[model samples]
Target: MKVEWKGVMPAVTTKFNEDDTLDLIMFAKNIRAQIDAGVHGIVLGGSLGEASTLLAEEKNVLIRETVQLSEGKIPVVMTIAEQATKVAIAAASDAHENGADALMILPPMRYKSTDIETVQYFKDIASSTDLPIMIYNNPVDYKIEVTVDMFEELLELDNITAVKESTRDIINIGRLRNRFGERLSILTGVDPLALESLFMGADGWVAGLVCAFPEETVAIYELAKAGRPKEATEIYRWFLPLLELDISPQLVQNIKLAEVATGIGTETVRKPRLNLSGDERKRVLKVIEEGLKTRPILPDYKSF
Candidate 1:
């Protein structure tokens, strides 16, 4: 399945049992929901999927399961975030062998590498795999920014074809479009900026909140891209609060809780991480509940 690299591709969360084990049944249900809702693709083991806590074998399960469930309906792109180049290469290799169609990768985790090292890191990984890559650039959270100049250097690699642009600077989206033109498929990584980015000519959205509100997320992207700005704005305004959750530190818990509220999945998170609680729990729930209470009737759009 060759990824079109346009439209809504969810950075989906990994569902777990109460024992903190991978719940393949429940996980499959979630993936099915996204595809059924008309998402263009699905991304696994991303930041929202708790890649840091996931074991090596666990990621393989996600990649293989997503591949089987999707059954070529949508491309299943696995994310690779590791500290060492060799480990990232091995992980990328494992994803490819297990049938991932593409990869959404971050710079070397923990230690912030220089621009030269960053470029080399991507080059080495791309050299190892035939799968196309979407460079995950979230400098605000990840600390290392893949500047346009670095991207200029990276353009030497043909397979480094897309970008998960999360710079949080909307101007940079335009910058990328103006700089690279069709050479790069820019997918907005920040949920709150989805509408703005799409309007700014981003090719697609790699979304987080879509885990809980798949249809609404897809609606916003389609409506905007279809040039129905008014209809898209109506939905985007209603979705802004819930979308804000994706940018928070407790994003995993927040999104999972929203999933539970939406009857899609559980709020159970792997340890070192816990479910939302106290005032924060109430606060998040209030936003989700309010949105549900007045859930807008989405305008009709063609299905993928």
Candidate 2:
């Protein structure tokens, strides 16, 4: 269950019942779909997984359940997105105890820490645990960018082994590859940029849209890796609209609706976040329905 930091690693959504309780049954169902579709790993409590509303112990439960469901076939990574370094470190420790194979950690939430502080934050968390860590570097949305200079300092820790590159700056992938070589693994965190990122030398994808469209997502990665761009572009062009849904402020609700459309999950979300409604709901549904209507017959990309 060692995290390879390569291939399609889903930043999966959290399923909830009408009463706002954890829907382990539905959660497992969606994860099973990802595993069957040939994902490399599954990430729990990510931004797409509604990490902000999740309780500490609840995360442990998720890690334990996902570990059980994956059954050692793939790695189960827990995301630590906390405002306090202490809390982030504790969460990382707890994930270690609960069988998480690795962790995806964000910069200090809410407060925009300086580059030095951010580097120290990640360093402290990595020092606190033995598990490998994937630094979530999304300055576009999270406001604290883990720049290449900062990464130079962070990579001093052996456990800081990978990065979830979400800066939307495609060139950063090449920068990381050129600077780090094989010292760090670069996994694209942006869905719309996934195919391009792979072509730009990313090792994998930390995907959001794959929660519903796992097979198509994996197909793009595999085909691109196999040097079959003609086949991969055909699907990536068709998948662009759906992939765009993962970049929004309401990505959690949007992706949940996609899951429901694919018949793999429910639409219940935590408070402060409701299901899509009005024109937004109709628009998202239109996109989902149209994608399903024309869902491509995937080639034998797996065989390659």
Winning model by lDDT: 2
Candidate 2 per-residue lDDT, tens place, 279-298, comes to 99999999999999999999
Q: Whole-model lDDT, candidate 2?
A: 0.92
Worst 10-residue lDDT window, candidate 2? 46-55
TM-score of 2: 0.98
What are the root-mean-square deviations of the candidates from the true structure over C-alphas?
A: 1.0, 0.9
Instruction: Provide the clashing-pair count of each candidate structure.
Output: 0, 0
Q: Residue-wise lDDT of candidate 1 within 1-304, one digit each (tens)?
A: 7778999999999888988899988788888889988999999888645888999999999899999999899899999999999999999999999999999989989999999999999999999998999999999988999999999988899889999999999999989989999999999999999999999999999999899999999999889888899999999999999999998989999899989888888888998898888999999999999989989998777642
Candidate 1 least-lDDT 10 residues? 295-304
Please report, in order, the local distance difference test score of every candidate based on alpha carbons.
Answer: 0.91, 0.92
The reply for model 2, stretches above 4 Å from the true place, is none
Clashing pairs in 2: none
**Off by more than 4 A, model 1:** none
